[model samples]
Target: MTETPQEQTAADGSVAMQAGRDVIVTNTTGLTLMEARQVAIDVFNANFIRLADEAASIASARADALREKFFDRLSRENPEGLQQAKDPGFQHAFYTAQKEQARTGDADLGDMLVDLLVDRTKHSERDIRQIVLDESLNTAPKLTNGQTAALSLIFLLRYTRNNSLLSHNALGEYFDKYVKPLASKLATSTASFQHLEFTGCGAVGAFQFLPEQSLENNYRGLFLKGFDPQEINDRDISIGLDRRVFMPCLNDAAKLQVSALNEESLESHLASLSIPGEDVTKIKGLFNATKMNHEEIRAKCVELRPYMETVFDAWSSSNMKNFTLTSVGIAIGHANIKRIIGEEFADLSIWIN
Candidate 1:
């Protein structure tokens, strides 16, 4: 559900694009540059908070449901074991099952499960609400009031819907219309970016991109510009962020495959598509970088070809379709992380800014 660089526009007359279901137009045309930038930041913050809250709420509900189902199953299946301490086998089996179930949940789920195990019925929406509220409060130091409000709006837009946010077009459009303005400001603000290093952002776009980092405890600040990624002890090195992108040639190839009437025909059609060597190389490098096995990547390419082709067809017919990443005026952050790991134990939170 991630939006490729081709699927976004700046909305500041810097770029005017309609990506899928969302339309991003230039909104900074009339206002002073400063006003335009502030407006963009406000919109971004609003969208961010909204998305964050939605993610928290969805995560909370899912975690609670899982906890209830698991404990209920455990209670029913191991009714007699709780009263006795002698059945180590039953205890081990129960715990093993619990562990497996817990694997399906993420960080928020883990927190919810601990609360549920402590007191099942006592856990409620209020508990999750409080956690989310606390998270917001903690993040407040990193954002302006306007930015916070913008984030809250974005969260509500996604959360109220019952369906999954699978449509990249819709998410992209929302960003273009509402979030792009703010993104411009944030991107331009050295201070905001620096502060955001510690204050993780809410999820946005189809990929649910969050500013959270893996190196939570190792955060310091940005190193010297253009520092090498190989020295882990160097104070200047930073952990790289993971930004997923869907390739253009692969996308085109996918389209060709889908329109074919049969698997054989699809393969034939795909074979005929003239994908560029650079794009193919980029795609291969992307797959390798993500640690995807060659066979799996090939299979994925085949499976995804059809939908991607449809996307391309739609894009070709309108302004929305004519977009490319370079045209979007947004710089996608890409870093070679293995090289980074060799160089630094430092957190990459600074890069989020």
Candidate 2:
């Protein structure tokens, strides 16, 4: 015959134990074994729920922070444009930016989203601006940080110009502060251009394939007004000026030369101002035209060798000649640059249509 169970109660009446074919235990809380097991499950679930709540709270805080930042920038930069936030399109984009910021925890991307939103208010083309904002928000998150960096570097090199005269020392400081950081984040492979093309940021093609004759014709029509045939021929011979050399072989060195000439022109414009002795010495030391020559340009190139190597690596990796940024590309590139550096360096007006 099976033995009958024996039960014992603790002095405090908080626990009970039973001895039988199967022993059962109770807790100090007066819970039976089965009740205690259910309590334990509840506790476990509560802990997980708390953790999930914490994560959600963090995401909410991030989203709120981004929203605050967007409003701050908007109020400061375009106070009257605050009415833009009332538009359905702008509201939709702002909501999307907030959601993405919460989801991705990327504050920089949030800034770019808001930047696009602010830019939208500046344009009168409502439908076009809406499309651009929607498409840009959709594509911006898809880009890796490295790819975004590549776009900014290209934009800086190809599209932008300094608004004010800067001494060589100032230029060097800007390069180190702004350009170098972007270069450091460039993708290792030229295939990045293909990715940019795939994302509708740009097109990768040979520069030679562009409408060269038309461009040359337009150039001659606009700027070749009073030049003599002999002078034109001499200029052409000096630079090997043709469609082939015009675009395809255009490199950083030529671009730098053009920049140097612009700086010289600016300096000449300001030559009448009488600066103090130390200021004059500093300016001359930094921008003396007589000292600016092939060797100086070569030295600048050497200073930029590492960054240029990354650029060459991208080209060699894909064997691509040129990448042209579409409007979408410009928007994203400008935003990324603004995030990496600041508005002072990443001027959107330069690329505005």
Candidate 3:
């Protein structure tokens, strides 16, 4: 039997179907040049419209979800403050957040905007808190999540301290739980710090002089704060001498307390500085003499070393040591940290005075 035109075209490597009087060609191999062009154009237009509609739908859903989150938080936390939504300042911030949320579709960014808008309802436009909130709403959207994370990490290292006894294990756990997730989102290049400076979130070179200060402060907060007196008491008991006699051990320990080293490595380094080939045992004795528990120190170091390495690598890779947050940066970074690590861990009280 002879094949029809459609069957002939199909056999010739062209897909064809009859739609009433029109021949709809999926493959234009058997069609004219103009027909092929028309098909290409139609396909492109159809796909383009489909993708555009999908994008719009996603953006609209995100905006709606953001509004829902905002009202939910406002109603629960500051029901009275909802009245301020009618005020110019609150409306401005709300709209800004909404516009940015639509453009970015970032839930974190939306949450931050919610925080700023909520905060605005609590303060007059003239208040510094409101002023900062206003500025933050403008600036926060310009930042990528990676840039915000970098800013927040720097802020935590510099401006905040642990309120309770600092433990290496706890520090490790904190970073693992709170920081590790964001760390993966960090940009591979140092441009994140540059972007932060350009956005007025921070100054790139401002912290150069105080490069080691954050690390030192962190080290002291983690290992030295309440442990010093305990070490002194332990030394006195072990050596059967006055606590004053073991003060030098505390002093030596302080000198040897390099922020970059874990306890075992630090002790080994300390021993190396002394008589040649000295074992870590002598270093352990030194810590023991100070009444510091060597075993506990080693255990803490075991837990903390990996976390320290991870943080230090991030800092070095991002050139974070050279970056210092401006007041705007501090506010945004504080908010970012609270978002990531929760409010209980995001203490900024030292900046209050």
Candidate 4:
């Protein structure tokens, strides 16, 4: 029997977060404003790099398991055909399946009779197209059956994991110590409003107010900022990415439906974003107009102080602590996508800071 996958505690969910939490906790609290800011930045960079390694390791293990299972099923079902499917002839067979799919619009490519004849996989469209083209060609194909199979397994693991980094309960005890020293510095910084409100948003009180809010938007924002969804662009590792929030509303039975949402569904959701607040608008406009240097940003921050003050008041208040994105903060946040981003997310509407 298996070891039940080692039920991950709130503590051991993410190694990066564990490290970050430790760094923050271990670092002294009496530092100056600049020192505290540097500490936060250091934590961010360490977590970013750590998440990259963790994501790759997770992908590798998931791929290995999938590869074994895929071939094992083939061995049990058709021992003789499994060997034959490795040859170039399988490419031709895949084309035949594609032709049939095109003609009849049948999904599953007639029970996946061809090696590379999948209509869809839990991978990117670009990756799927590359595999399809490789299989269609007769000579010097870019991918072989085994290679494509391995790639498919990796892609499946990535898609299911949600973005590049695997998220379990992050921001556990790590930030608890740092929240105070960092709060004043963060409050003065662009990130003040978002971080201030983030703490209470995860509470049951938040759900009571924004009951009609989409489950995705609920946990997807400020609270989960540390969860990096690192993007891989042609082997380049671009940091500062955020991912979709997990199944906040769904039980185990409906989890499959959440994973089944296709690219079209994702696009539909992306097209609709919240409107930005005046502060975010001004910051974005200044940014777009003149590159938004530090002096200008500082000036804008002064003007935006009242809005941040409201957020600070709510955070201090016991009753209204678990509030949604207040009308005052979103504008500044919308335009101020620098480090102010509660989660380093770029796709905010007016509602989120």
Candidate 5:
């Protein structure tokens, strides 16, 4: 590998301000700065990012609560209360219910506004407050705010309560198939509360912004690692850092991104998906099926069960299932089909070892 150029520290590398407040970077570490003031800027930025992440998490929790509250009460699944559901006054009642729910949260959500509001001064609270308290009672199809906003959230729960996206039957099927099984798992899970893979923690794509943003994240890291903040920042010039160290790191960052690295199987959120309950039901029914009476077939079934179950487990992530096929998807899918349709159809065992 070609060596990084900026990592070549000078013979007597020292970073100090001789004249004024201008910052400079020195040394070979290629990671941090060498000035007190610059270090302070990083400190400030890191703290800001932390606070921002917390606020984002809280806002996400509130939106989830709102979705649940609306669907639970007004969902027009199959009901004896069709008269009120069909009544023209239902729109008013729905909005009124939402307003009431906003003011008073249920047992699951604790107190919606009170529980979610991290700090009064945070800008997120203002947005949430507007969402909760702003009275847009009119249920017309057009814009109710009397402005032609570019891209604003338009929630039409009143219109969809009967049969659209939130159709009672579709939700019920989804609940039974995808959600109900995960309810217990989620309740006990401490893994950053994944609401369909978008965690309350951090998620970002390819972002291009001012170097200040980069400094925000890195400055905090330096402080946390017990580096001498002043010494580090004093020698670290943004220009040298950007050209010599930072730019190079950016080019190689993607390779080091994920928690682990392996070539065992390529995985994608897309590819074909296995039937959810088929493997489980097969395992459950295997106890009674006369189809397994043949000892040879029975042994093969037993051997294939784990792979089938793995397919089931891997495919269970709703956030992952998509339209594309990956190497990982193919392996699991072939196994799943073998288990489901019998080995006569899926002659894939030869490819496994």
Candidate 6:
């Protein structure tokens, strides 16, 4: 299941709620009921804009408390009284459904938000969120202030639904179908220049450079195992000499070899990428945020802290090879990644076996 968006403080002290499952955001401070409603409406409208045209019908058909609140008491109590409502069929169906649902004593609008936010994306998380964004935006012109805030809260619900589906659906499938097998192949390979196929991660064309930080598993013997001390040393030397050594030399003759090495090693190991077709020239631009100067690195890390942490957590939870290889290794990798960034990267070892 997807998680919910959390309320967080924006620079302006306005509560900003991201419309997704990973975090829920809201701030009830500084605003009248009407202004909150307007923000909420704007949010939902923006969400709807992210969807396809077909989702408009679904949005129109949805039973929202926002709309119901606009209705007089007679509309809520008399089925025929709502006949003149914009969507009589839908309203009637909603009334019927709610009537039955009320039997469970959970007919509140909060409970119905799930249905209101259905993504109808044929089960894809991207499609779901896109649908919500699209449809919510489509309904923007018709809402009032209070209705807007209420709708924003409702859109927040949609964001959660879509995020959960995306993580568990798209990402889950990606790891199962590609990351696992490729990481396994690389792990077991004897070649000095190991290659991982990136068919599933959506990368295109020839060999590409991946940052070491991008790697879900520790690049050190990530796939291969059971090597003696001599073998480990040999592998390290081979990695340095065969791959890391020449990365930056291709770009600038005078560039320090160490700088290139850091960029190349970090990109290759962390990003799970490599030079495409002997074009080591691309290594010049490789970015391993951690290997940069402390000031630059810290700034980048702080800006990207949330996303990086999330990625690390998800990656660690999925990568299994390293964790299975040795408890000591897992512990070390976990502590290392967390110290460098945060716990997000620790669980990537879980999915690598």
Per-prediction TM-score: 0.20, 0.57, 0.60, 0.17, 0.15, 0.19
List per-prediction Cα lDDT, in the order shown.
Answer: 0.29, 0.53, 0.56, 0.28, 0.25, 0.29
lDDT of 1 by residue, 143-256 (tens): 453333233223322222212222334434433443333332222233433333335542222333111110011110110011122221232212221112222222233211
Model 4, range 1-353, lDDT digits (tens) per residue? 65433343444322222342223323212433333223333443333224366664653343333334334444453443333322233323333333333333322222222222221121123443334323332211222222222222211211112232112223122122212222333222223323334422111144322111221222222112111122112213222111231222122222111111223333343334332343223322321222223333223323433243332332334322233332222222222222122222332221322
Backbone clash numbers for all candidates listed = 30, 0, 2, 9, 19, 64
Candidate 6: Cα lDDT at 2 = 83
Lowest summed lDDT window (length 10), candidate 6: 192-201
* C-alpha lDDT (0 to 100) for residue 106 of candidate 2: 77
lDDT of 3 by residue, 1-353 (tens): 87555432445544333432322233313444333333423332232223377787775566567667777776776676655543445555666676678778888988777766666667754766777778888999999888888777777767765534244466667667666766667653667777887888877774452314543434432433223444434444333323322232222454332222234445544454552233334434444333334334334444565554555566665567677678778878777766765443433333521
Deviation (Å) of 163 in candidate 1: 8.2
Which residue runs does candidate 3 get wrong by more than 4 Å?
1-57, 206-212, 218-305, 342-353
What is the per-residue lDDT of model 2 for residues 124-207, given as tens digits with 9 covering 90 to 100? 356554576578888888788888877776666566655442343454565676667876677646666677888998887766
Inter-residue clash pairs, candidate 4: 225-343, 274-350, 275-350, 276-350, 277-331, 279-331, 279-332, 280-331, 280-332
What does the lDDT read for residue 270 in candidate 2?
33
Flag clash pairs in model 3: 231-290, 234-291
For 1-353, candidate 6 gives per-residue lDDT tens digits of 88665665667644454553122223323444343334434444433333356555445334234433323232333333322222222223233332322222332332232223221111223343334322332232222222222222211211111111212134334333323322322222212111111111111233322222332122211211121223224323333333343323222334322222233344554345443422343333222211333233223323433343332233233322121212222222222222223113313223222
Root-mean-square deviation of candidate 2: 18.7
Residue 64 in candidate 1 has what lDDT? 43
Distance from true location, Cα of 330 in model 3, Å: 1.3
lDDT of 3 at 235: 42
List CA RMSD, all candidates: 27.8, 18.7, 19.6, 28.8, 31.4, 21.9
**Stronger candidate by lDDT (1 vs 3):** 3
Estimate the lDDT of model 6. 0.29
How does candidate 3 score on lDDT?
A: 0.56
